[model samples]
Target: MNHNLFGIIVVFAAAAAWGMSGIFVTLIIDSSGCSSVALAFWRDFTTFCVLLLYTLVTAPHRLTIQKKDILWFLAMGCCLGGFHIFYNKSVMMNGAAVTTVQQAAMPAVVTIAAWYLWKEALTREKIVAMVIIFSGTVMASGLNLFTLERINVTGLMVGFIVPFFYAGWTLCGKNIVNRYGAVPCLAIAFGIAATMLLPLQPFVTQPGFLNCKIILIFSGLIGLSTVGAFTFYMIGLKYVQAGIASILVMSEILFAGVYAWFLLNERLSFVQTIGAIFVIIGVAWLSFKKPDAASE
Candidate 1:
């Protein structure tokens, strides 16, 4: 029981750290002016080094990647990698407030995916929650939710990918964890994803890629947000109930809104506030339900 409590604490901390990543990345980009490719490469590279160092020092003997799971890991890594690149890119294009809204929309996607593809049963309460969330967010976005305004179609598409691919990652993560154990699997996946970006740094990068200061900032991302925070989350999840873990992560949206509004000087429109509220409520409902028809 104590172990479980620790895990939940880790997960909550990871959620908050993740929420801050956007604001951090935004500051980095404002200083660096690098393309998404370069920015992504450095980001993943820093994380790779952190994961690699930990694995080498602590579990050098245990770091073998199964030949079978190698391919699976690679594929998952690509999807996961793409998700990060696109999510960060979205923040670069859209402001943090909107990015937060878009991410807040993820539970809807995960629930929908689980229901339709996994055949998970959805309760009436869950459906109502989704509806309320959608209505509220639409109200928050103000200028017709579907219309192109400050957030263009390209940015919109990229922003949406954050949840879409994360939902996909969540699905893939279950299989990988079942097969290879989470730590090594996550490590391998990060390895493959990092390798996927090594070739493009020169072709797409500018002065920022070489900036020592930017490099340090990027490493801060890996250290605090990715490695340390995620480690806490993974540990916490092992002890706490998954439903509780999901609920605890609701803090990300809250954190993001506070950080953006207070630190980043971003303003949230009434519509966006409504949308954010809906997203929180919807996710709370969806994450709490038991999977019946979803995963037989």
Candidate 2:
């Protein structure tokens, strides 16, 4: 098989694995009665442990970072920790399909932030894409203007915030990722996030929280979705162009919708389905358009 083709396949597999994250969260919450925060903590802690071990054994040099980069790692950790907490909560509140579709606005958010912060030009294509993405996010979230009851206002709000947290990490890790490599940066960030959330863990208050089923669910979440997804996606990036990889990664949203529909019996209205299509189109458009500046 061609190397690029193999990379594409691995990336798609990673996206599919990531798509299953919401299902795992739902199952864990249902089976263990764990709060979103607890789940986020355990997920980060376990993923960190695994990645730390892998890096330590295979490439210990990757783990060495200058002390000056600590702040960047801290910012990444905060963003990552916040992302997991909000993402899990959004899944719990609004279900996976809605949350993932809403999250499709992340590229737009990051683009706008880059324009604002780093003077990256906001091209006509980007502006149009952002408009489409935001509109689609509203629709995908089932936010009907006329029908108040059909709208989950809180869930929509929570879901909307997800992209900002996502963008935060993306921006923060931009340079740091180059400095220390993706896996090590991620491992450190996850470790920091786990440390931050350790105090909030409910192990002391919630008895029998560590059951067989929950442990298995956590294993899948941490092993497959967190570690496996990131590792495979990084490897895929080596073989695939960034633009193509960005477009391909949108498969995560579709995979999430399919998983939610079949596994959780979640259904999208016709309008919501159209909204999801809009998101895909907008993000793909953005991916195809060249950046205004080469530096960007």
**lDDT top scorer:** 2
Please give, for residues 5-84, the per-residue lDDT of candidate 1 as tens digits: 45545676888788778767877888888777676776666677777777777777656766766666777678667777
| lDDT for residue 21 in candidate 2, whole number 0-100 | 86
Question: Clashes in candidate 2: how many?
Answer: 0
lDDT score, candidate 2: 0.74
Task: State every prediction's TM-score relative to the real structure.
Answer: 0.78, 0.80
The TM-score leader among the candidates is 2
- lDDT of candidates 1 onward, in order: 0.65, 0.74
Question: For residue 241, what is the lDDT in candidate 1?
Answer: 36
Q: Model 2 segments beyond 4 Å from truth? A: 1-15, 117-119, 137-145, 150-157, 202-210, 232-251, 265-268, 290-296
Residue 267 in model 2: lDDT: 96
- The residue-by-residue lDDT of candidate 2 on 1-296, one tens digit each, is 76667766777887888888888888888787777788788788888999898889888998877899988889888888999989988988887766876676676666666667656565687667667756765566576656656447798899888877877776666647667666887899899999989888755323134588777877888888999887676566555444344345656766777777897698988987887798678766765555445333
